[model samples]
Target: MTEFRVLIVDDDFHVARVHSTYVDAIPGFTALSPVGTAALALQAVHALRPDLVLLDLYLPDTPGLELLRSLDLDTIMLTAAADPESVRAALRRGALGYLIKPFAADGLETVLRGYARYRRLLETPGTLDQAGLDRARRALLGAREPNALGRTRSGTETAVLETLASGGLLSAAEVAALVGVSRATAQRYLAALADEGSVEIQLRYGATGRPEHRYGLRD
Candidate 1:
């Protein structure tokens, strides 16, 4: 395998550091700047043009999905937010992978290994027959999942996500009602969902009282 370079982008210093360390520690990989902001992430990609990017969807300056649309580099979203819409949106914007936050190094390593293998296979000489093309299509949809889906420790949070996905977007109270959970439980789930990469938290303007933060599927 050839030398692989990666850029780690996240708002948290420790998250970036830990991810960067795990990436660099992999043999035959060279890690470039592990940056903290969306701007720095873009700069690193443009200047260094690393082979892969471990991206965070939430950044201090810009919405993470927008950045993915503008860049030409291969990227994987590594984030705490697990909003289903966000996950689908990132994939639509052309992110190569999405790994939810709180992932261990083992998950990261599994993705890296698969990506590396894919890269190698990609470089191999090939002639595309109809069968080969058809096979490729079959393989593509099954491609995003890592070796396993990381278990989410929060159950109410998962139920809340299901509700939001069902309704497209819902106010906190609506979410609470749909999930058949208490308002406080719904609020906790929303925060947890925001952290897990499954749901998006946005403020709905022109609300009756308390500018309601609407829960939407991440996009």
Candidate 2:
């Protein structure tokens, strides 16, 4: 699988680090050092040419939307600005996706994954069928409600969703303990939910070792 490079743009250093961390945790994706200003962002894009940019709406040097219009690269608006005009401008400026700030890692992951899928479809060698074309279009833009996990093997998927819906975040191990499944089994179901956009997975970075994944139901 092709690994997509990401450049994170945000004014807050710590927030940029957090978003960078989130990007790194996801499979098939990697992020470079985050840039704090629009000028640095443009410089990084010229230098590195990342596959995508996680852009924030506010910057010390300029409005993020203006910067978005200036750039000729793909972007996902990761911002606290949720006003109608911001949304309209982002869409008009060709943002691949719009994600409000303070989102779980899974929320971003879902968008990235969908983008990757869309890219793959476009890169495919032949003409696309109607279903293929529709799927690819939705992958980049957006999708209708995802198919539920109820169709999985046995009734365990239902149990997993119920556990997640009950409130609070859960690690695979914790969910397994609650739902009477092995940790690995729990993790698989949680990943399925993340892929389906039914739940969001967050990474809890520790001082040592890899980060841990925490699962939460999507809003």
Q: Which 10-residue window of candidate 1 scores lowest in summed lDDT?
A: 139-148
Q: What ranges in model 2 sit over 4 Å off?
A: 141-219
Which lDDT tens digits does candidate 2 get at residues 135-170?
677767646324552445448988998998899888
Q: Report lDDT per candidate.
A: 0.72, 0.84
What is the C-alpha local distance difference test score of candidate 2? 0.84
- What TM-score would every model get versus the actual structure? 0.60, 0.65
Error of 1 at 48 (Å): 1.0
- Model 1, span 1-219: residue lDDT tens: 266899888888888888988887665466786888888887888788899888898898988898888888878899987999999999999997889999998788667755654454345467666643443333332242221247644667567666776756688788888789888888776754543335555555574655566778755
Prediction 2 TM-score vs. true: 0.65
lDDT of 1: 0.72
